[model samples]
Target: MRVYSKTLKEFLDAWPGKKRFGIYRFLPLFFLLGASLEFSMINWHVGEVNFYRTYKRRQARKIAEEILASREST
Candidate 1:
């Protein structure tokens, strides 16, 4: 844990003011950062997860199926 302790010390040293953030503010930011990193890595799934696509391609497929079902009843 030497690396972690050293990094922690560095972070504490870098704070600008004499007043510090309370644990409440600090913990939430830490958890948010961790969760964001988790989702960001999942985005690397690319093709399987469609990471960069604005529109989900599955919407068109579902609409096509519904249209075909309606035509069959005629």
Candidate 2:
């Protein structure tokens, strides 16, 4: 286990650009990626469909179905 951990650490330390700019440097890149994904999810659509809109409708339908099923069972 110790050997594997040491090997993994070495592999990560050898990642490109890690020497020039520590691991923290990748934080901004990931942040921008997340922001861009959020922006697209909010703004981009296919014809009139949207990611969040579909997700919300599906969740509402699921809850309604659960409620109906429970009532019928009782």
Candidate 3:
């Protein structure tokens, strides 16, 4: 069982019994909160072209041009 995993079991054993149970009680809520955050932040593009990719490419080109101009001037 997960309770017997080396690290988790060792940690639970090292802590006092009440504190260990308190952590277990909040674990499910933490998992739910993490899942909700991941879902909300996901990038959704079912059909349209990826605009982020194009924007990053444009930014990179501009940076490269500036670097080349600086090297030529120096």
Candidate 4:
């Protein structure tokens, strides 16, 4: 399906003979590799206290203060 211009639906529509089942090598690479190596490349957690967590918390507190101030003004 990737190599040719024809989509799976189009190819199936042009199938010869009367058969309900058809073979497709849709994700040939994933099938042959037999592993989800793509997902294994990332480190899910970097330390319990990272810059990312600190930045997010700081930003959230700032936004909350802004919201409270706006409500008081209104």
lDDT per residue, candidate 3, 21-73, as tens digits? Answer: 86586577689999887664455444653556567889999999999999999
**Any runs in candidate 2 off by more than 4 Å, and if so which?**
1-21
- Identify the superior model by TM-score, candidate 1 or candidate 2: 2
Score candidate 1 by TM-score against the native.
0.34
Model 4 per-residue lDDT tens digits across residues 4-57: 555766765675532533454334544756555433323234666555566789
Q: How big is the positional error of residue 53 in model 1, measured in Å on the Cα after superposition?
A: 4.4
Q: What is the TM-score of each candidate against the true structure?
A: 0.34, 0.69, 0.36, 0.37
| Model 1 lDDT, full chain set | 0.67
Tens digit of per-residue lDDT, candidate 1, span 1-74: 25468778788656554256543446766899999987786576756664434345567778899999999998
Per-candidate count of clashing residue pairs (backbone under 3 Å): 0, 0, 0, 0
Per-residue lDDT of model 2, residues 1-74, tens digit only: 25468778787667667767887756877999999999999899999989999999999999999999999999
Q: Model 4: what TM-score?
A: 0.37
Q: Locate the minimum summed-lDDT window of 10 residues in model 4.
A: 36-45
**In candidate 2, which residue pairs get closer than 3 Å at backbone N, Cα or C atoms, i.e. clash?**
none
Number of clashes found in candidate 3: 0
Deviation from native of the Cα of residue 23 in model 3, angstroms: 46
- Candidate 1, residue 30: CA error in Å? 9.4
lDDT of 3 at 13: 63
